[model samples]
Target: MATGLHAPILDWYAENARDLPWRRPDAGPWAILVSEIMLQQTPVVRVLPVWDEWMRRWPTPAALAAEPPGEAVRHWGRLGYPRRALNLHACARAITAEHGGRVPSSYESLRALPGVGDYTAAAVASFAFGGSHAVLDTNVRRVLARAVRGEEYPPKATTTAERKLAESLLPPLDAPRWAVAVMELGALVCTARAPRCADCPVAAACAWRLAGRPAYQGPERRGQTYAGTDRQCRGRLLAVLREAHGAVPKAALDVVWDDAVQRERALDGLVADGLAEALPDDAYRLPA
Candidate 1:
């Protein structure tokens, strides 16, 4: 079954994979690493322009490391999760100081980098260095759930069984290609909301399809709410700092969000998270 799964998915991927810049042969490990980090909880379309600009400005870890952490947050430009900018800055510094300005090829080394986790380490190792490791992102997990496990959806968090299943299906040769192929298949075809099973390469062999495409029976999936939340308030306050030439007056932040209590909490949270600096004279700025 694994062999059968491999050929069709690989063939489909060869014909249908998106021609993303990070996937190009000339794209280095740094580019791939940046793309992976930027892509967390952010869609591909939104990431493209920001990624292009970042690569043009800081082509290597050393280039980014030379700049202040504030520059990273400033350039982050509404990617939604501003903390990732700080994390990436720290990662670049660590890589430049420790790894000779190169992205580590091994999973262990990549995992040790700031903000990198098991999934990220495995993904970087496989996608960037051709190492054979299970790369279980949300897309890959969804694909495996329907195709192999006959389930509409996997668990909310990755489980031991899911990891074992993903590891078991890894191909002997070109495992990286296989891992990405499955991921693409999930992203483009077997989507979460409306899976195009008819267009799926493994439709005939898909257990969920064979079982009549049952609806997800797990816990209710909740959509993220952003508006009127602390997160939105933080983004608004951060925008003020990002655009300012120097420290922004507290009044500048106050005008962005109405509720004084929520606004103050958001600002305080940003300072606590190292995303902003509170000045002595009631001013704020991106970390210096």
Candidate 2:
């Protein structure tokens, strides 16, 4: 079953694959690793320019490892979840210190690197090293759910069962291409809000289509609201700190948001998370 599915997907990908920078033949593993990290919560369009700039600045793990964590946070520039910056810095350090400035090919060694979770470790191993690992990303999950399980959407989160189901569908060889193919299918065809079912390569073989394309029955997960929320406040606070070369006066941060309570809470939360530091003069800046 996987073999039949593999051929069309691979063929389609050969002709129709997005000209992603990370997929370029000349792209290095470090470039692919950075792309994966930046793509975690950002769209491809948004990630492109940032990924390019990051690669230009720090093409190797050794370069990034030499920089301070605060520099990474500052360079992150408007990407939400600054903690990922901290983690990326840590990951670069580990890669440099332990892996001799190279990204590890083994999943276990990759996972042992700082900030590398199961998903990231698997993705890097499969995509960069051509290892056979089940790369169950959000897009892959949605694609598999609809194509194989006859579901409109994936489960709330990755589960052991989902991993097993996805693993069962992976091709025996060139598994990396298969993983990227399915993810691309999900991103371009089987989208969450508006899937272009008509243009899908595997539309005919899709279980959901055979079953009359039933919609998902699970509890509706609401999209996150960012306006006036803690996330927004966090972004504002981080932005100010990011722009400053040194400690920024608290008064400057206070101007970003009107609600004093929320602003203070956001600032304190940043400090608590080690993303920001509080100076004796009540100024804040990215951790030194």
lDDT of each: 0.92, 0.87
* lDDT string, candidate 2, 1-288, tens digits: 445678888888888789999998888889988888888868899889878888999999999999888998988887667798888888899888888999889999988876678888999998899899999889988888888889998889788989988788778788899899988888888898888889888888999888998988988977888799988998988888899899898899989999999988888898898899999888888887
Clashing pairs in 1: none
Best by lDDT: 1
Separately for all candidates shown, the number of backbone clashes (residues 3 or more apart, or on different chains) is 0, 0
Q: Tell me, by TM-score, which candidate is best.
A: 1
Model 1, position 170, has a per-residue lDDT of 82
Residue 185 of model 2 has an lDDT of 83
Cα TM-score per model? 0.98, 0.96
lDDT of 1: 0.92
Q: What digit string (tens of lDDT, one per residue) describes model 1 on residues 144-233?
A: 999899999998999999999888888889999999999899889999989998898999999999999998899998888888999999
> Worst ten-residue run, lDDT, model 1?
1-10
